[model samples]
Target: MTTNNPMRTFDDSRRWATDGTAMLTTAIEQLDASGIAAGSQLPGWTRKHVVGHVAANADALGNLISWAETGIEKRMYASTEQRNADIERAATLPADELLTWYARGATALEGAFDRLTPQQWQHEVITAQGVTRQASDVPWMRAREVFVHAVDLGTGLGFADLPDDFLTALADEIRVKRGLSEDDLRAVSGSLPDVTAWLAGRPHGIADAPELGPWL
Candidate 1:
């Protein structure tokens, strides 16, 4: 999927960020119409919690972008506990406020990315997992946050709700993450619609294989 065009990565990243914000906006609107409360999902967490977490991740990435640009290490948070507390605080906001904050956070992130030079995209940053990765991976990471947590909210939407190109790219990414080869993906092939379901840990056509957990 390489392109001869320069700035392809930047263009793809910008598009991903824009599309992700639109999806989140839609999800929040649906949540409002459905009258779903914050505490609708996992124990001790609500729809607000999920939204807040997504916002927090955007904020973190925004900070990382700033650090990359300035050559100064602006720590995203004091600690993991602080990050979790920030999410909790954001979650306590009213549904309207939380949704608005999520939108603002996404916008802020995109703004940070827009300021980056092409060379800065590949600048190394240490991840929470202690692995170093390119700054360009930030949008993809945030996309996973938005998309997967959208599913966690149990909105009944899955990868199928995304563009087919996005789903195919995501499936390829997941296959690599799960240590599956191209042959493995081909062996269990059915339809493009099933790829999302299979990636989300649902049993589809392949019964003998171990249950696929959430890889994104």
Candidate 2:
């Protein structure tokens, strides 16, 4: 599998963010009118929960971008408790407030990315797990958070809702992330509907499910 080209990755990130924002905006518009208050596909998470998670991720990625620029290693949340607390705090805000915050977070993220110099793109940053990655990985992370969580909201959207190029890129990423050989995926090829389905682990007929869930 080919590693994502930096320029392509950057461009894709922008597209993903733009597309995700559009989806979220539409969802929020409907949600506002319907006053639908319910949990989503993620266990115990309401629509609010999903939006909060996406917004929090945008803020976290913004911080990571700042860290990359400053050459500082930022620690991920100290614990799941802290992480959940933050999400809950954001989720509990008034619906309109939460939506505004969510939009602002994305706008801020774009602003931050716009300011990054070419050299900064190659700068390495260490994740909380201590794994180092290129700064370009930041936007990819943001894209995943926005796009996946948008679907997780149980808003009748799926990977199929994504652009073809985005789906293909995600499929390639999923293959590598899951350590599945191209041959392995090809061997079970008939089972999978598309790259997105394979990425979601809902490959048409593969019954032995992978340990990882659809979150990836």
Candidate 3:
């Protein structure tokens, strides 16, 4: 449902899901030997933490995909505290091991996604936050994780560098997710990148803007 590229079917989201993984992988690999240890845009999170969290998230979403496939109730995480503990534990691994973690988790999730039927994609599953959504949304959720965290790595890629359609859908989603009204959107400039970057709580340099809390 996002990106500059033309996506004409459900199949296309699968493609972007793969593409986003590759994008993040390349960004991580390109980092200097010490870069993965550097701070990310996220507070108190190194690039290692960001990548590790994305890895865990892939596996967590795979649980939802399995739920959709089998009609069983599978929570995204065993518990919120456990989830935090997992990320913290993962963040301490060596950089090469972190890449292994990401590869294994992402590969498994991608394989799980590949097997679902069209009807299965429509199945409802709950998020860690208690939000219920379609199983098909899982791929986009992964895409956002990799793409946004690629930028959060603080190496390079910006909102403008992501696919245009992706940014458009992301901006729209954040607006609704944030419960922003017309007036709220009007508070930012109409530029899609600027608006999305602002909505995402990135450093958009919105002059004299009201301070925004953290965003997803």
Candidate 4:
């Protein structure tokens, strides 16, 4: 069967994923013990929640990598309940412990990336959202997480600071997700970053940007 995830063919996914991981690592390094307790840009979630989700996501995506490697079905999470529970549990970890998991998870995921054969990259896998996709899209999926969540951590980084290619890709992706046409996106009244934020349902700091929808 063919994979339908739009990012499946983005060859820059792996490199951007690496950059995103490093980007978060830098931000995480700047946060002190008390920093995790602070509120992030994402409503109702603290920095700890954001960090925990990033760490958990690495391990979850690893399951998809394993699925590709062995041609066996491995769900990203055992269950949605289990997924939320895992993030909560990670959130309660000591600052150092959580940081360790953050680093370790990325290491393991990247290791898996290195190990996958060219043939394995074409293997079909399921996303947490239940979409069928090629393993090649896994890095892009991870890229979406680390980069966006890094901003959600309220670390002063914003969409404007993201790599040009990624922002361009993200605007396109979110546009499709929001069911807006190219002209529709063009009609948004702001800079690319602000418009992208509006499309993703984040606060665009504009006077009256239409609330498109929640983050995909």
* TM per candidate: 0.81, 0.81, 0.90, 0.94
Per-model lDDT: 0.70, 0.69, 0.82, 0.85
Q: Per TM-score, what order, best first?
A: 4, 3, 2, 1
Candidate 2 at 102: error in angstroms? 1.0
Tens-digit lDDT string for candidate 2 (1-216)? 112553245767766877876776677567862342577777777888788777877777777788767777665555668778978886678888888888888888888888887777778776645677777777777776767676777778766676677666676678777778777666554322354565665322445544446544
3 or 4, greater by lDDT = 4
Off by over 4 Å in 3: 1-12
lDDT of 2: 0.69
Q: Which ten residues in a row have the lowest lDDT in candidate 1?
A: 1-10
Query: For candidate 3, lDDT tens digit of each residue in 1-216?
Result: 232223323555676678888888898889764898888899999888888899899989999999999999999999989989888987788888888888999899989988998889888899988988888778877887887887888888787777777777777777777888868888766577777888888877566766567786
lDDT of 4 by residue, 119-159 (tens): 99888899989898889889888998998888888989988
Question: Per-residue CA lDDT of candidate 1, range 90-143, in tens?
Answer: 766877777778889888888888788877776777665565677777777777
Model 4 global lDDT (CA atoms, 0 to 1): 0.85
For candidate 1, give the lDDT of residue 108. Answer: 89
| RMSD to truth, every model | 3.7, 3.5, 3.2, 2.2
